[model samples]
Target chain A: MTAAATAEPTRRDFLYIATAAVGSVGAAAALSPLVSQMNPDASTIAAGAPVDVDLGSIQPGQIIQVFWRSKPIFIFNRTPKDIKLAQDADWQSLRDPQPDSARVKQGHEQWLVVIGICTHLGCIPLPHQGGFDGWFCPCHGSQYDSSGRIRQGPAPLNLQLPPYEFLSASRIRIGENSQA
Target chain B: MSGYSTYKPQSPFMQWLERRLPIASLIHSSFIAYPTPRNLNYWWTFGGILTFMLGVQIVTGVVLAMHYTPQVDFAFDSVESIMRDVNYGWLLRYIHANGASFFFLAVYIHIARGMYYGSYKEPREVLWILGVILYLLMVVTGFMGYVLPWGQMSFWAATVITNLFSALPGIGDPIVTWLWGGYAVGNPTLNRFYSLHYLLPFIIAGVVVLHIWALHVVGQNNPTGVEPKTEKDTVAFTPYATVKDAFFIGLFCILFAYFIFYIPNYLQHSDNYIPANPGQTPTHIVPEWYYLPFYAILRAIPNKLAGVIALGLAIISLAFLPWLDTSRVRSANYRPAYRVFLLVFFAAVIGLGYLGSQEPTGGYVIAARILTLYYFGFLYVILPLLGLFETTKPLPNSISESVLREGSPAGASAPASGA
Candidate 1:
């Protein structure tokens, strides 16, 4: 219904425009603090710095949890059969298709390194539980296979892999890697 | 607003102020002398009530903030101190907390009034969209405010809601991380939220200025949904509209004070009194009552990303309402089919809200799903089809005619206090 068809520009229209322009300029001037507040504060950025883990003590078939970037990182020392199961699984049918070799470094197949939080809703998944048993998130019943792919669950992707690399035979640094 | 301004300032100070700023004249023209439809109802009073509530929230919030600490460790104790140690702090805290709920209650009624009258129809589309933007801003502000207590419910609500962003495709986790300023809802997140929560209300105020400016620009939509055709159909805003608004606001304060004094914690979760422990999640997690209908819509869908999108759309869909309902007729008063559907739609929303509060299971999930479907269907299906097929009743010739026909309380009788 062209109900209030006052589209024709008038002196009041110009007044509104001029005032709004001034207001917008003032808003832009005030926006720096609004934006800068969201940036990682010094303490938070410091907390996010690279964390080093000594995997020497992490025996095969053992899973150790380490904190890096304020997230739990799981360093799993997979057994030979676990690695085989992870690798030999049909990667083609994965909800989030990433092969087992891709999740770990070239010679680090037995050392499965991934973030401990579930891909579904960030609840920490229980290690070696649920069907196909890599990690099971009890929050919403999301299942992750040994390779960490979302095999048969509501999690859209596999558990996230932090930027990490093998610094030595039994050591790794998270939050910084050559590729990333 | 009364076809021409005869506003000539006789007072020396007003003349001096008018020449320098002209804001005095603008206010007078927009508020006092503005011609409101003679038949405007108590529903119209909500705009003034909302403005008053915003002022209440800001005043109480600023005072509360003087004592409140943003640190997660101190946040809970700081709120307790506000309740226990600070003088008049308990009253201030209670009023501010319940003020938010009352604000929502007012805004929801205001929106319902607009919908029933089709205030969003042509010429007011921009105004309606601005209102939606204001609603979005309020939702964000409310959510951030909810997290400031750092209580169990507050902390977990922050966790669940911020993680809702992570359902986005590739940038989801990154956005969530950025939002949190870390991997989880922590001190950094709390700090940012506190800052933004304080900031958004001012922005809402700014939008409210524009909302009123647009209302004054286009003029008010009355119950008859008919535009003012002549000077006889409208009256100056000063005595009639202002008094009615004041009367309603006074009545509303009784209810507001009731909640503030008698049952401040009724709207709050018992779980929120307990401090937040990331390790221990409460058995049943739900947002505040105002957010439940939306929370229900989100959970009704099984897929994570889709659920998030559905929830997003539940709010965003409102912006499209002006265009979606293609009826030339402006009000449901004349449209019989629309009137029934609107009733059902409101009930479904209430049902969805109730279902959202319960544990999502065999019965609740089924109910939520059905209600969620109806919620979407009301806007997406019912409104559009009703526009095409509904047989509308004949409109009264003008607003004055409708008011005269009914012997309305707000009628042609001259206001006692004239402008």
Candidate 2:
């Protein structure tokens, strides 16, 4: 047994290792399809295609919810006061700190587009409800500011921004973003 | 480990089969002729009760699944149709649903019995750990099973639970999306959860087999925490243990039947009857009552990532208990201080569970925090420290001594059943 332990690697050992390695690779390759099949399928991906929201009908201080990829998207047409209140609040002192300008398009600051799901848990927040005048999650007491930044609650981050770019001044396409 | 098996086949065919397979003799040695400590009380019956509950859940779940639809659009209506249309469907659905609660109830009692008797100590650690694995599987299986109806509580519970993965730093969001199988909890999510719900119970059954195997290897821990030193200390597992188990199982089944026949939906949340709507959440979203203690632990912490970790640790901590508890004494009956602490620990867990159902508000949050502290402190701090300092009461030299001290003839009658 000692001699066997001290001896150089034999052809049988190499064969065993080679067979085991190849078998593992084969097993992994077989499992890949089974595992990846659970991911977003072609139709689900197609269903999540960029939705075009026509912002022409929106009035100031109005927040209209639209479904994009089965998630509620809150399109808040921020009034001048709403935008000012969002900007004037000390961004650094907030729970999830981000400047209002960073959240919305610099020129399109009046139009705040955010995925309306609560950051703490994925419940759709009630718009214009909470002390922050943005959203309040009823499931847990997570609150968001008018700029969609988390103000005061258990939520750890700002309300997420969907990928969107301005098609024209009054039109935007969600799920597609372009450089400023 | 107990006594030598004297299994002799009675007939030619059985003898031949036994020579070839020996499965009958194996069962004879393990179950029929196995030497069980005569001192095992009603608490020991939970193992058999749990096995029965598992079978009950599986048979009922499989029948319910035959009629249940796993689509987002049809899942809720499918359950409704099962209640109204399918023959004996409501019975199967109620049995399967309530079976989950009673199953957890039995497991909790079983665990408490183990802790009280220090059954998780050295020789039985593997058995305890396997039980923990079964418990974790049961939790996941139960969660997914609740998601099958696609009700308000089910959908939101899935969303929030799957989002727990998002508490991880960099890969969190991707993992959450992977779990959902799409952008959000919808058709794909429901389908995968249904598939897994069906698959997990069988895995639990497998683990339970190992749990029993481990139990048989170590043998049952008795109230005295004393190992059987002589044949008189033990009784054959057949008529004695089986009869006791059957009696308790009958009583347990009566309770289970009462829940199913009379107040079937009493344990269930009324909000679950409402169809799952992604746009609106229930006024207060809570998980099944079995999960309340851990849920309370999760919400006790204010931070998201930390809370998720705390929740995971709450379950995982039980696996480490065999080592955390450094007491040489096996049973709480011998450990005076440990017994008091054990009862307090039970109360804290019950308190936290109550807090979990209430709204997470000012007074409730504070209460939950206090209980959560005691919950962890009892396991991590008190258990380890008490073992080293506290003096234990005098223990019986052997299992038979304890039984004799009680003036019970059960142990003496063991040898009367001569093979």
Candidate 3:
């Protein structure tokens, strides 16, 4: 193809190149309206802004679901044994290999918070259902360890960790990516 | 291209403008005075009708978009308001909705016309491939548009179809998440689909310009499938082709208006009236009528991945058609064996579409499997085999012979030289 083109340009060849170039440029210029739309709008971003959850009322060993930006967020108040189990589980053979230590915030491991939605196909994973006792996606049979690492089935990643921080002994803030 | 120039400016200012941009000359050469085969039928007019339909869809779609919200909470209500509250919004919304159905209606006929006439053969391969590209765009745009109303069928259809991508091994989950921009098909997915749904029609329009440009470059293929041979074989596109296209456009508009006015929901699913609830899935989840035939092919296979592959191949096969049927003859009119297969192929498609709409069951599944076999068999097996083995009728000496044989002179035929 290169050799054929290297030979002097036929009129048709010129027309093809010129029209393709012109069409491509026109397409690029026309795409701004759509490309600009994907950027998070003020209202949508504002909806996902930092939300504070009252951890004071929640008892140990219990998990509750909260909504931020229309996504379900799971806040788990882990007991001492729950924290030890999550940290001590073998991390060598995970579908998404991340250690328990890496998942939770340093010195705040007792308050385990993760996005409630399953990574397999985005269905909400039911808590305390799998062999690992983390979560189980009924939609696609994905199992997550207590650390939220995918343990089995078709899911390729662990439950996503939302940007969150401990606000106090009894409250936590989500959707803010910063050291509090 | 055929060398026919319809422009000759007498006024000095017009001549100066012509020399600068030659817009008048381009239009004159491409449309007004272009040479078309004299024996062309109403089937040939569908290309013009499709062009008109595209414009109508874009105009109506743009107006509908102004009042339509993209959020999941408000999308269903917004559509209801468009139907109930907005001034003449019902007319515009119905026209846009039914216009999509009519657009596909015209396109299918247009495609069948090309297939029957062998318009995809040599020198026209690029033209046909561009059409396939246009078709894919239409499918994507149409799918996204269906999801925008945020109805029961729309949500589940989006769920089912999006999950089809997860049939891919390993990479599937990440791709789905990336597509959704989150764990589920929530705000991000809807926003992106809305943006793309709005964007693709203009892209279709752009490709259409290319389709027409290529048409002008190579010229139209007639029912005879023979290239024009001399001046007597063809007529100028101006009054002759224009008049035919106009008449057909009028007839097509009548059909389009009837559906919009009397039966706007005829093509829509009854389930779509209910607002989208992600938790509840309709028992009989089906795609639109235009997509049914392919949907049937998808469900015929029990395996999920294979079903997706089969569904994809049904469309991909069309792109390779120009090379698939290796016959020197272009028109099926001359190939009696080919003609029989084409009719059966058309029926098989319609049958598959019907099976698709009904719930897949014992008989339906078995029938879909058989029809699916025949559908692929026609393109992959029968078409190629017939091309090699079948005996075609003797060709007319020229396009003029074919045209003159049809009747007397249809009009003032500005015959062009050479096939």
- What CAPRI-style quality would you assign to candidate 1? acceptable
What lDDT is reached at residue B47 by model 3? 91
User: For residues B1-419, could you state the per-residue lDDT of candidate 3 as single tens digits?
Assistant: 33688579889998999889888788888888898988787778889998998899899899999999999899999999999999999999889888888888888999888888899999999999999999999999999999999998888677767877887889876666667665457667887899999999999999999998888888899878899888788888888999889999999999999999999899999999999875444545678899999988876776657778899999989989999988889888888888888988989999999988876657888899999999899999998888889989998888878666656556633232111
lDDT of each: 0.85, 0.90, 0.82
Candidate 1 residues lying further than 4 Å off, grouped into runs, are A1-37, A41-46, A49-66, A73-116, A124-154, A158-180, B1-4, B408-419
Report the C-alpha lDDT of model 2 over B208-292, residue by residue, as the tens digit. Answer: 9899899899888888888888888888899888888899999999999999999999999999999999888887888999999
Which candidate wins on DockQ? Answer: 2
Question: Of the pair 1 and 2, which is ahead by lDDT?
Answer: 2
Model 1 residue B227 lDDT?
96
The alpha-carbon RMSD over the true interface for every model, in angstroms, is 2.9, 1.0, 6.3
Candidate 1: Cα lDDT at B58? 95
| Model 3 spans > 4 angstroms off | A1-180, B408-419
Ranking, TM-score, top scorer first? 2, 1, 3
Report the lDDT tens digits of candidate 1 across residue range B7-120.
Answer: 888899989987998776777787788888887778888999999999999999999999999999999999999999999999999999999999999999998888888899
Model 1 CA RMSD to the hidden true structure, in angstroms: 7.6
Cα TM-score of candidate 1: 0.80
Error of 1 at B225 (Å): 0.5
Best by lDDT: 2
Error of 2 at B7 (Å): 2.0
